[model samples]
Target chain A: MSLEKQIAISPAGELAAKLNSAQLPVDACYQCKKCSSGCPLTFAMDLLPDQVIRLALLGQEEQVLGAVTPWVCSSCETCTTRCPNGIDIAGVMDWLKEEALRRGYSIPQVQISRFHQSFLETVRLGGGRLSEPLLLGLYSLRSGKTLEKLKSGELKDELLLGWELVRRGRLKPKLPKKLKGAGEIAAFFAKSER
Target chain B: MKVSYYPGCSLEETAIDYAESIAAVAPLLDLELAELEDWNCCGASAAHSINHTLALDLSARNLLIARQAGLDLVVPCALCFNRLKVAEKALPVPQENKGKTQPPVKVWDLLDYLTQPEFLKSLAGKVVRPLAGLKAVCYYGCLAARPPKVTDKEAYENPGNMEALLRALGAEPLDWSYKTDCCGAGLALARPDIIDTLVKRLYDRALAAGAECFVVSCQMCQANLDLPQKRIAKKAGRDYYLPVLYFTELIGLALAHPEVDKWLARHLVDPRPLLKKLGALSAFA
Candidate 1:
């Protein structure tokens, strides 16, 4: 059977509509492969950038969500800039990641997801700014992998670098002074939860 | 020219040197940077990926602050600039502010300010030390000049604004392919292996082009390239010693300010030797 014959048209059309509403024109992508060619992390991704778009256009949401490409994308926007169709491929990748989170799919790249949560928590704690030490500490604890490196002393180089940064006043030991409108910022996050 | 400045989160903490250098060089170029008071984070990569509405609201709050100030906003961090600029375009007008067809305020990247012919002309006469022929490559990274639609830069793919500023500072800007390449940005913390690979490619190309150092505008790029070059070099089994400095820091050095060293000392990879070699340091030093 032809690959086209294998796909269900109804679901594919529905997925395309959903993606269009999110401002990601996956249907506009012509499989030029320019996005994949320009993506720096393609070597590490399970599927190519172009493949992700093609699968989404075909409404293969489970496969697309399960793949590691969306989670690993750094949102560099190189693909979006280089796309001949101007499809905002990077934005589509972001949408895929968001959908994966919403649908409760397990992220293939656990570290990246952990870092994102830790980063947002750090922002919330700082009332907007990032506290470097706090972010690193929380990320280490939350990820659990960094703690393994720490226990095994494999992170010694990172420690030395941290000390050097401290000496030069780059990394402060204290938490950042929270912005005055913490309540308002917290409320915005709370509203978004709904 | 007076503009509302948004230093974002990194500038307040890890990238304080970037903020210091910008302040140090602002007066010489006749630019007055008034930081936006009570400004919150732009949500950066964290919020945008997780919750789109939250990202829009976070950046909208900051833009509203700038709108009320009635001054054009200047964002020094590329990531923050991208977030704010994207928000300005994506957010809908609230019911209270509907039908206000015009954009409330314009967002300016630091390069947008420095690249102006008038600003460059004014800055040229203020150069006490003209970088003394230092060969440097301009690294735009991703956010400041990419996804042409969001940034609306004409030369997003091959931007020459940084090169123009380099020439004004009397440094030789080497033309390279990785100017707008990604440096792994926030992923630097999550995936060092990926950053190692990416930074290695960048360093290899810069070295091949005979660049003594890199001039960057993004705080994330500066952190990734400067802090990890040594480890990346070791991993790649190449002897690389390139120093990455913020473009503003170079301006601070060329201006021959007494406090320039204080700003230089904050880099993980020391940039003084490169500065000294090029004779870019002031006689007073």
Candidate 2:
């Protein structure tokens, strides 16, 4: 008799599989569904916590990979704590989100993603996180066509907060030093990409 | 003393300065950081609120991993530390998660890690340059001390560890009211509308406390306090500026240990003027 062929999984599927495998002892899942009940953003998810896991167990790569549900998770640990199964749902979700993004799927986090992208981009360029310029730049960029729509007086009001901090002894702006272990951090992210 | 170190995402990307300072000072204190291999996110507030078990599993995995690796984990980010601690407690409790192990590891926040008397003594012994007269507000955002389940390491934990650490380095750690206030962590994403209120509160409080500048352990806290305030100010029609220094930068400054230019000067909102006020320029230079 011919042996059944092994199914080839996409990067996300492979990631899910790796996560499950690495997440061995996940069999402890009691299915109490505390994770589902506790989640703040559960309503926003296309596939709730348990479904994501069930799909992951079934090795349903396409659905898990293509789903934007993973990115919607804010890496909050609400479900993981309540789960009797002892699964790191947040970690798994994060892994899935990272994997989905790696596979070239546009799992847009919308506003949050934009915020993350802008903040991280600023960090990537400057080597350390910056607040004022990052906010100004991101808000400006996000405003796009809306920039003109914002009343000049309102724009001035907003810009003045940062200016006030700068003027007072409160917010002092300076180049925050970068980490010596930056290469290690970069390597970790790079490895995750692979 | 050997401790496991979990430098969360921000420590790698946005809070690099803190990393650089740790690299410089860890050896001086004879404090060894054994970073766990194959660690995952600690599932900060967002993940925990989404799925409690998953969050515990993520942190438990790290703890179990750390237990297996033969060291207690030290997390630099308050959020990561808090999340992991919450998971550690909730996972093993019978009423909480009980009897599960996917990801396993015990986690400690940076302040807790350094507050260990032995470690503090060691760091104090190795201070080549003291902080002298520098005054800084110990800004501990809500993540480090609030939400009892997550930050159970201490009863009524104060953000004074950094201040104490600063004092150990011969710098003055200011007593400030905004130490445990919420810096509106990732809220800048979902609720940009209200972040100004949160950011401004922290800024105003720190200033009112008469701190020369603010120092924080979390990258996100610094970002929220430093970056989003501009927008919040823009919205509030007020100018909000506070030099948010990574605790490590202050450590480097106090100890006269300037290793990385990027680490010393990487705030998106420049901290030079504050440094000048603190009399840290020549030492940094």
Candidate 3:
């Protein structure tokens, strides 16, 4: 068995690229670990916010891409605001989420990427954003597990939430009757994907 | 003056008092609330935790909906206001990756909309009886002040703007420790155990600092302090209660409406005792 771990990039080169590119201050990360110290959900993460930034700066892209922190970061920005050096760790985490997905890395615990993608797909399909049908679809998909959780025996709970929105006049059934650049924006996201 | 009103999800349900208060005070301020039609949840804690872009998109869509209505938004809920402001900050920033998607709208906070000079001037003249002697502790929870990127224009730790607004309404605003602390928001839903601790910590600090009662701008915060605090205290085996008033409710009382009873009567925690102590509660049978 091989005892050595694979490296993502040579540390020196990665640090140089990060220094030039990342808006967060690499030197200001004071190793105090305040970010990890304050995270409310740290128990759920394999890599802490401070550690992800540290690894990214260290050119450990393989380690970062494989880690669970990026997917779990709520972008609460609690870690960033509490950082003594004012580093935007949450922004870095957001960057990492996009990067990890681009690299085809998956997080098992986060486990809801497909559901979220469905929401975006709904937006793309409408030529703009619409929440009610999109969320109903998302909820129905989620209701599979939610039903099992309901020993309380109320599957209509989800439907009731939707109906409540309707009663308040907050939810609507129709998409924008017409939009000028709807086709253009959808085309833009589609082409950008390529 | 016209303002786009974004009464976040809780307003229609648990925090209806806040909606009532906003409605009561809006006419007095000569402010017109053009409600944003077909608005969705701002995705405060859940969507943000589960999916980042979806959260931003949810908040941004509300903003764009307001923009489509040709009005900038006003939110009475601090969490919704903060989420909208954060989404606004996130939307304009160019992402690094070329092929990745982003949310398609910009967002703004209620404070951001209300603080505009002309709007503030309109609110100034509507003060009828001015809460002369009440010393209010302006409680801005973590949601309203975090993410310095979103709160760049407003000072996060020192949110004296609420104080300034209170002062303008002729009430003295107290500087207190629990001003920006968590009010155990949605934790009351999924994690009631943790809320007992967070709520007590918040109320204790304000009581110690000599605050008459808490004045808040968030429905979630108001719910925790107003209705749920008694249960929280009971869970902790402590007997303590503090009156939490919406900022709009204070302004409403100061204006001396005939309908003040309806508004004050709606509070799960009665504010009449505190208002009478402040010499502002009036002759309403």
TM, chain A, every candidate: 0.90, 0.65, 0.72
Q: Which stretches of candidate 1 lie over 4 Å from their true place?
A: A1-11, B92-104, B282-285
Q: After TM-score superposition, what is the CA distance of residue A42 in candidate 2 from its true location, in Å?
A: 22
Could you give candidate 1's per-residue lDDT for residues A1-194 as a string of tens digits? 25884555445577778998887778878888999998999988998999888888988888888889988898999898888888988888888877888899998988888888888888788877678899988988888786677787658888888888889888887876667778889998888888
Model 3 chain A lowest lDDT segment of ten: A1-10
Top-DockQ structure, candidate number = 1
lDDT of 3 at B83: 77
Provide the TM-score for each candidate, comma-separated. Answer: 0.94, 0.59, 0.66
The 10 consecutive residues of candidate 2 chain B with the worst lDDT sum are B93-102
Task: Show model 3 residue runs off by greater than 4 Å.
Answer: A1-28, A33-78, A82-86, A90-194, B90-108, B115-125
Quality of model 2 by C-alpha lDDT: 0.61
Candidate with best lDDT: 1
Pairs that collide in candidate 1 are none
Candidate 2 residue lDDT tens string, B1-285: 787888865555456667777777677666799777766555455334433444455566666667668576888887777767766665553232246443444467776677667866776877666666666788776566654445663544354667777877787777865576555566555555546666676777777877666778777787677666456666678766677887667656656665734565656567777666656666555
Order the candidates by TM-score, highest first. Answer: 1, 3, 2
Scored by CA lDDT, what does every candidate get?
Answer: 0.85, 0.61, 0.65
Kindly list the per-residue Cα lDDT of model 1 for residues B1-285, writing each as its tens digit.
Answer: 898999887887679899899998898888899999888877888788877878888988898888878788999899899998898788654344455544457888888778789988877888878886799999998898777788878888888988888888888999999898888977888889899988888988998999999999998899999888778878778788898988899888877878888888899888888787766764635
Docking class for model 2 is incorrect
